[model samples]
Structures are given as C-alpha cells and as structure tokens.
Target: MAMDRLFAPPAERWQAVSPRLCSLRRALLTFWLGLLGLGGAIVAGVVGMWWLGAVIIVVAAAVYAFGWWLIGRNWRSWGYAERGDDLLVTHGVLFRTLVVVPYGRMQFVDVTAGPAERKFGIAKVQLHTATPATDAEIPGLTPDEAESLRDRLAALGEARAAGL
Candidate 1:
C-alpha cells in the first residue's frame, strides 16, 4: 500500500558503503589511463604522429570524465542488509541486481584490498558458498568495517550451520 516506503532502506537495515568509493574508483581509473595516455603520447610523437598523440590524450580525458560520472552513481547503488537468515546485497545503476546468500550456506568470508583500495583504506568482503551461483560480495567498506563484517558473517554462518 505504501510504495514510498518500499524503496527506502529497511529500519535498522542496509549498511551503506564508503562514500569515498566514487573518488577511489575515479582515481584508480585515472591512474591507469593516465599512464597509458602518457605512453601513447610519447609513442605517437616518436612515430611522427603528434596529432594522434594529442588526440589520444584528449580521448583519454573524455573517457575518464564519462567514467567518473558513472562512478558516483555506481557507488551509491551498493547496499547490504544482514537479515536473520541471509545477507541481502543490492547493487547496480543501469543493471540492477540483488543477491541473497543464506548464512548457513556461506563456506567462508574473505576480506581483500588491492593496491588502489589499500591506498584508499577500503576493502571488499567476498562471501563464498558451495554453490557459486549463490555467492555474494560487498565492496567499498573501510578495512575495519570490512573485517568486522567478515567476522560477524563467519560467526553467523557457523551458528546457522550448527543449527542445520
């Protein structure tokens, strides 16, 4: 009956990821492409195609700008709620997806951070299950938060499995 409340995060539910994720994503993209742009410019200049090099740089900048636009929206799209029996993960902007992983179904939980993610002090939490199709992941949380979530999930998994 109340459609307005349907879209909202459930009461005391849905822990949001770090807002800095957008900047972290954009920075990672820029760092990777910026290096390529620099190399391309150098190579084109060596091959006597100064114009091509300039065009490459311009295109790189434009692409980065477009991708940066999506980073914010994509960052905002992620949410996770720990229900009594399962974890609900929702993400995506143009392509929405929802994953439900039962606590008893989780085989393990992994917390990871790549170079860029470590630099940004963010980590991703991956949930492993016997059924790969039921696995889920939650990204863009601080290292501490990620570890806490991992511990909680593992405990919940063990408790749920013991009951089963």
Candidate 2:
C-alpha cells in the first residue's frame, strides 16, 4: 500500500495523534531567552575581566541551539496511537521508544487540561496501570477526543476485568 494511502482515515483502524509541539512563538522565546542569558553572562564576565567569557558565550550558544534542535526533532517524532486492545506511544529522535499499554492492565485514566493546553484546546490523557512505577500518558489530545478515549478505555478495562 502507498504511504499516504496507508494513513488514510477510516480504513486505517488506528491513527497517530501528536501535540502541535513547539509553536513558532515558543521557539522564538527559547532562542531569545538563551541568547539573552548568554549575552548577560558575556557582559558580566567582560566586566569582571574573566578570560573565559568569549568561550563561555560560544559554548552556551551552541548548547542552546542544540537543545532547541533536539526539542524540535523530538516533537516531530512524538505521537500516540490507540489500537484495538492497547494504547501505543512512540517517541524520541535519538533513542526511539515505544510503549504499549494493554487495556486489561489499565487501572484508571485521567483527562487533564492545563492553561496552555486549554489555550490550544488540547488535553492530556494519563492511563494508570497496575505497574508500580510507570504511568502511560497521551498528551496533546482534543478535549472531546480525550474524554471519549478515556470513556472507551475505562469501559474496555471494566469489561476485561469482568472477563467479558
């Protein structure tokens, strides 16, 4: 099957959903904040007659740029998909990780919307499992979508628990 056609809606039972990631405004903010801090340190060091000011500024700028690049790359690679019996989360650029949470193992689901998420009309769905240490999460979902998913997951867990 063709790649585009593979992702065509309806025919594909599972679809990947990801947050919008960093907006242009957010990226600009990150860059400017980084630059500002670097500039401030440079000025302070120069005033203090520190010999390593130039090197520090250069290193800081490089680190900041690298961090921004990583964020953007990871953002593009991060997404979640809900299949028949499990929720799949795929993330990371350098170290790819895929987490599968089976419905039967789900303990509870939480649908939460923070200020930033509300501004973007997005919500986060956290799926708690019997696992003692880890909680599965699907961030950047629409409010209605998240609620619907939560309900469906809850019902599935309940049905599975009842041996349905």
Question: Which ten-residue region of model 2 has the weakest summed lDDT?
Answer: 4-13
- Residues 34-131, candidate 2: write the lDDT tens digits: 77767777787869946667666667778677777776776666566667777676666667666778888888999998776777677788889889
| Model 1 misplaced regions, further than 4 Å | 1-12
Q: Largest TM-score belongs to which candidate?
A: 1
**C-alpha displacement of 150 in model 2, angstroms?**
1.7
Alpha-carbon lDDT of model 1? 0.88
Output the worst ten-in-a-row residue range by lDDT, candidate 1: 3-12
lDDT of each: 0.88, 0.70
What TM-score does prediction 2 earn?
0.69
